[model samples]
Target: MFPTRAYSRDAEAIVALRDDLARWQVASGIVQWKPGEVTADQVRDQIAEQQWWLLRDDGAISATVRVLEDDPTIWDDLVAPGTGDALYVHGLMVRRTHRGRGLGGVMLEWVESRVRDAGRTTLRLDCAAANTSLRAYYVGLGFTELGEREFPPPYKTLARFEKPVG
Candidate 1:
């Protein structure tokens, strides 16, 4: 298994990783996250809240993701009221240089383990509706599309997905 740990310091490194991916998305015409949208402060808060995790390879951060107990903004309308039967994953990012190395699946499996450890039966996540490749990737990973939702300005339609955990 790839070495994994909860995010503790160097929030800037995570931000940099996300910005790099955002730039790559734009250059590749992927309508996903935007550059300069992720800030160190936000990362720090996430770390402080114990919501972030990192996967390291050869002592360097290879990927990162945020796992949360609840995400009302994107999931409230979809999940049953007051049922905390799942863990939500957000901001999954892999370093550009580390793409195609299965790090994304590794990190997701780690999160699935966490979900099981937490006694949750499901893992949930969402991506931009315009990102067909990513949506298909999630589907290929055993995640079933829950539905789609449209939010206010600055946020496009989002496709939500969930996978059952042991």
Candidate 2:
């Protein structure tokens, strides 16, 4: 198991993790619309929203993900709708060099534990519809496809999936 830690929203380490996440999105061809500026302020906003998590190994940030603990309905229209207690996962990414090192699975387990600790019963996430490999990857991890949606122009479609925490 990798050494993990929970980072506060104001942590400076998250800036690097956010850059890595944005880079991964570009490298994976998952982000069609590139932001002109990936400012620390933007990263801070994500953290201030209490949706960001930084995973570290040997005291270095290796990956990051965001958990939506508030209303699931916030993303209900953006992804497949779900009922009951659940946490929505957004922007899960690992450093390119860190990919294929089993860190993703470890981080996922971390997410599950976090959701369970929050008294939620399920975890949900979504991926671009065109990302077939990613869809299959999540399926391999036991997440079931619930539905699909087409985000407005620029982002055409996304596939939604969910899995029970317990």
Candidate 3:
């Protein structure tokens, strides 16, 4: 639940989910994530701050994602001081076994509901610019390109995308 619970009761589970996603990303070589890219403390903080969400089925964590209202590293150039208010997505992932099952769409649908409830109009995200397939996947889901940004470290470039949610 994103924006539902303020803090995660099970911090270990959140860390495990992130580590799993990072490991999968590395094994798949489709993303720049390494297993330790996100630390336990960060996961705890994300959960405590209500930015992280977990989807469960049969009482186990099936997927996880993050939503934010601000992302300075990626959106700084495009947003003015008082006008950068939109739902931003980060680290969206389904378990490797659940990847081809359309869970991503379900997560996006959930996000849309949250955005609507918050009276927001846009849901935005950034994907690695080198990841053509990933970019196409989001485009297929009807997210339009806002622009691209060159980052200084870790990430080289990212394509900004947004879809009207409300």
Ranking by lDDT: 1, 3, 2
Instruction: Give lDDT tens digits, candidate 2, residues 1-166.
Output: 6334344533556666556565666887864324433466666776777777766667677777777764444356544555547787876767667889877787788889987898888888888787787899999999999877776755657788889987
RMSD of 2: 3.6
User: Model 3 off-target regions past 4 Å?
Assistant: 1-9, 81-84
Ordered list by TM-score, greatest first: 1, 3, 2
Cα lDDT for residue 25, model 1?
94
lDDT of 3 by residue, 1-166 (tens): 4323425564677677767877776787767466766676777888778887777767667776788877776787887534545778987878777778888888887888878887778888988887788899999999998877888887678889989975
lDDT of each: 0.88, 0.71, 0.76
Segments of candidate 1 deviating more than 4 angstroms: 6-8, 80-82
* Candidate 3 residue pairs that clash: none
Q: Top model by TM-score, which number?
A: 1
Candidate 1 residue lDDT tens string, 31-73: 8899998799988998889888888877778888888998888
